[model samples]
Target: MAPLKQRLSMKIAFITPCNAIAGGLFVVYRHAHYLQSIGHDVRIIFADGSQGRQVTWYPNFSVPVSLLVEEAAAPTEYDAVIATWWETYYDMFHLNARTYLYFCQSDERRFYEKGLDSPALLVERTYCDPRVRVITEAKWIQRMFQNDFGVEAGYAPNGVDLSRFHPEVAPLAPRGPRVRVLVEGPGGVPFKRVDLAFRVTARVPDIEVWFVSGDGVCESHWQAARVFKKVKFEDMTPSYASCDIIVKLSTVEGVFGPPLEMFACGGTAVVSNVSGYDEYIVDGQNALVVAMDDEEGAVDALSRLVSDAGLRQRLSAAALQTARAWDWDQQTPIFAKVLAGFCERPIPMPRTARLDYLLLNRLRRLESAVSQLDPVHMALVRSRSREISASE
Candidate 1:
């Protein structure tokens, strides 16, 4: 008889809050996709706070504690649970698995002046679980978490989706004047510092600002300026495709998503010197790095890119090269190692024929249950989640 083949040994689950919106959940999505590519049975557990079927919206709001207990009674028998954010960390704590928390930012700073007790401390004490605090860039913030908060941290800087954002590609339609700049929003939560965009636009009237607004922002902000509201997430690349430059100056950020996305698009990126900006963006190379004090720096960088097409061409080329290096294919392996390390099993188990059938049927049922809700109700729930988070 032939020797029995070695069986693969573990299941890994990622727990996210509600939905994959504009922040850490996006990172979770990228990790899940990449982890799947590498032969891990990585499934996302969307606890009550999120829209479960919509993998796009992650880590929503927590379900009632009693409901969560009943829902997760069996706990899916995973080899490990990786919690991507604080709310998910709480969920993972209650689950029956070796748990790890991927803390993205300083909880103190994240909840500063917001009046909630320190979530990191609460989770640490209540769960008493092993955690691997992860940070984007911002060495200063990292130090605070370690030295001040007394938590050891790890660094796995976030990356961009390179295929969706490449400089050689052009927008399908005519983007007027070819002087496009990417700005996130002029309204919505004040955290993004949309006012800064308005001020910068006024300062640099020569350059056209392209605004990308999320669901709740008012249309008037766009009417007063060049704006693109409700752009499909997949089609957002076109905004980058048409742009000559990308400018985002936010008050707070984990990894500064737009600048990285723009850099991947091969456009010159003029980003504020904020938390996590310095991790990859180098001054005078790949992209232009500006100081927060000097909003005029945005104009100067744009003016330079506009006048020197050759320089623009070179930066664009370098930017794409840099972006390609940071693609999911490259970064995911490191992410996988960190995830796999948290679990007891050395190798991920292959899905059995029965397991595949069960997953398919289960996902179908979840989809049906979620599909019952109307689009407007779904939006309302999501908006409510944002308000709760903001208040917290």
Candidate 2:
């Protein structure tokens, strides 16, 4: 592709974690993609090389990914090498890049335990590091890093692929007089609160509820709803299209993506009244926000949205407007300007880093091999095995 603008083109690399269908890594990938599209030299290298999982191109994304194959892969000479995760902060730290940046997708401290290997302090150190320019996806995260840690940070929110996930492509189907309700990440992973969804579902027996998750997040609660496992990224249009009300319960997040995807595909989002969603989800306007612990309120909100067609259509229209604002076409130039400020650095990669890269590459291969099993089916197998063991 020819360079769009006649200026400020530079080499850039994103030190991303795992080649999974994850949100944070995708944001980094999409950023790299946008920079490349605008005629900049861009590459996405896996952090530790160990997480260079098997699949480079998943249906969820369309970016060409690469690994730190050689010690020379990450030469300090690159214009900028942005780190996508906390662990990779150390990777970017050791690299001899001219300009170093950290992509903060969320407040990672939420993932750590008090005394575990993932200590909050370790994650906090990356945020507080003076050498790295911190750019966060959420304003709350930017404020947290600056206010609590006394660090400088900038905010850059995520955008949806409007062309790919729009209402026309995934048309809403006739629900045959029954309100089709959709709940994401069922009952496991404490934050998703699928269990609470089950409670709400029980209250609204008249409506039809469907659950979706790649992992066994809804294993125990599978019987509570019509569950679909490992729904491929491309295949989710129908899921979003058919549902009248989508209730996504998250204890914490960084502007959750699925709700936006649903919104883009003509579905109304009934989300938790938490930091991640409150920024964009204006209650009664675009989305219905339920209090974190208010299961009854969640039920009532779902009932109100499903039963009222005008309310659902109006909210979805406003939601589409919100989604349109965050489209990559609009945000790409803004992101380019932010990185342009730091690409002046030029350095050389150390030969010693090769050893670490090779080891991680080997481990990543092993992880890739093991992770090939369908996560949900594997969870089922493990559950059955345990039951057999107990019976024996």
Candidate 3:
């Protein structure tokens, strides 16, 4: 007899801006894919319609998908309706559903757009809207929403597709005599600090740096390196596999996906000492950590990694250990539980959750202030960061 898969009691639909090559969008697909695989009737509705389902990860995705051809295409009701981005909320709020969820991946309030109160603030307010239950991906993001915005959101980290990024790709893969470095660019996103990453690439000698983005930042700058447009999701592992190092120096990130993706592909990452992944990364153990503004630190880490192949191997192996626990198989059920809780009502979070939020949130604020201070002010603040953390 065939075993039946556990299915949701009713249908669920996720509304995405488009099926584009983006980390957040990929996370959405994973959520929908997992739900569909478990016998749930999940659908991906295109909010942008014009994106027209052009390029999916492969020939086809796991679940049935539809497009919002007109205003009528919007569903009158569902088991749940998830808005993948904040802008989608304006439309989603009007739609009928048993439950509404904001699948928040970052602090959308930080994201800029023009508005009467600033477009970013308007997005921030959506979290406070009683109609939408908020689900955030990273702990740092949970802290941000809870402490700053007073929204007690659910936390569900995005899981890597480990089968596609198998360890087998790492063993004796083809390599050239020269080293390869990879950098990601969203072009104008301030905190992503793509420009800093490109600068580090330029400083390194005798290595090829590849710029990967659709932002066309390379069209205006960093003309020396090759630009590889974002490939299908299935191809991403191989792309990371071909690289010796992944360097990201984003000033603010709840959690960046590229580093974890590179780790799974048997590569080492040199990343910024940001809040979110501080839980997963130990400076010299799994991956190297560089401060956001430390130009010398960034240069030295890359230069050293290029010169030391053994260090890369050790880091890669340890990183795989870190990656194993975060795979989709582990995170999926936890995600399902969060969704299931909302099916009834907002689950009561432990009292400790609030304390953790205030502490981490304030520390992040202090950290950001120190990062932006003049060298003299920063030196004093660093002296007090530990003290503040203890006293609070």
Candidate 4:
């Protein structure tokens, strides 16, 4: 690979599952935007066909986007086609590209029950594909790929957009006598463990619990004092600044961003010892780190932050320092260099992988058609399929 200063502009395509307001997808879009700014011909391919639809959540997200159909039929070829999610991996083989890449944001297999779902197995299989070069957002994920799958994955840590989430941003709500504790993450996602954050915070007295969800849905049982649903990305700083502390408990993560964003907004955090928190979170130093699924421990940590004003102030100050070190301008160039290196060595997709994708695509389309015809029968079939998968 040549030096960064000597690298020329190369055409790149990032295949995304959808244009949803997801943290992972936002990272992908940010990468595309960064590459475009540096003179690379970059475009985002929406596998779900949500092309030309504006992502209203992200401010000034002006990266070019196209549907998978358009890319598959286009005359110009991409220097590298990267898969941003597991489902989009299958679509990579269909596009015209010199080299293929898989940007594993998380251990996606952990999203499902082990040995009880075919999707988990399929996700695992993508890691084993020899054609696609793997890159990840977390160091632990890079290590997991090497130790478990014997694949050398590149690592590029996610960064906080300091310009948007900074201490200078005014709080959305006025500070009062009661402490405001923020709980972030989608409500319904099981791995996110948002319910646990709400449950633990509820045990602490005299602290207002605020919930912010990228997905618009918040369950009635969560009982949050205030809910900010689907907030614009650039507009999230005020929400974070309004709260004193944020409690984010997740079972799986890829260098999660909300806590760091909270840190950038001059707020402390209470997070679980999930895989990626170790990247920056220091227990009792910058943020309170509790064990996963330990409800009592989380409650204790939240209470400590709420009652001990000195501790909150000390931790928030330290957190701001940590956030300062993780700027987007510093981290995004690492990924661009990875892409430049990948384009230097092109690998042809194997015939077997191409055939496998064709067969799997046909089966999935048939399954989708059947589910549309009889929803009840398909539900029963999925239940039985889970049973068989478990047995296998």
Ranking by TM-score: 4, 2, 3, 1
Candidate 3 residue runs with Cα over 4 Å from true position: 1-8, 69-75, 113-116, 170-173, 188-190, 214-217, 220-225, 346-392
Alpha-carbon shift of residue 144 in model 2 (angstroms): 1.8
Candidate 4 Cα RMSD (Å): 3.7
Q: For model 4, what is the error of residue 82's alpha carbon versus the real structure, in angstroms, after optimal superposition? A: 0.4
* Predicted structure with the largest lDDT when compared to the true one: 4
TM-score of each: 0.72, 0.79, 0.79, 0.92
* Residue range 1-392, candidate 1, lDDT tens digits: 22111225446666666543555666766666665655556666766643444443333322212224343777456566666655555455455554444545433244434333333333333222224334333456556567755665555556776666676567744456656667774367665666666666556656666677765475454423456665555768877777777777766666666777777876777677766777677777878777774667866776787667788778877777777777766665566565444443233322342233233334333434554677665455444433433332
lDDT-superior candidate, 1 or 3: 3
Collision pairs in model 4: none
- List lDDT for all candidates, in order: 0.58, 0.69, 0.70, 0.84
- Model 2 misplaced regions, further than 4 Å: 1-4, 48-64, 68-76, 115-118, 171-174, 186-188, 224-226, 344-392
Residue 45, model 1, lDDT: 70
Better of 1 and 4 by lDDT: 4
Model 3, residue 169: distance off in Å is 2.1
Of the candidates numbered 2 and 4, which has the greater lDDT value? 4
Error of 2 at 135 (Å): 1.0
**Local accuracy of candidate 4 as per-residue lDDT tens digits, 13-38:** 99988778889988898888988988
lDDT of 3 by residue, 1-392 (tens): 12225433567888877766677887788778777777777877776776576556542576776775553355456778888887665445444567778888777666675663244644655666444678888888788778876777788887776887766775223557777888875766677787788778789898877667644455466644556665666656666777778888987766778888778877778898976777577889988998876778999998888888888789889988888767878887677678777766743323343343334334444555766657786566445544533443
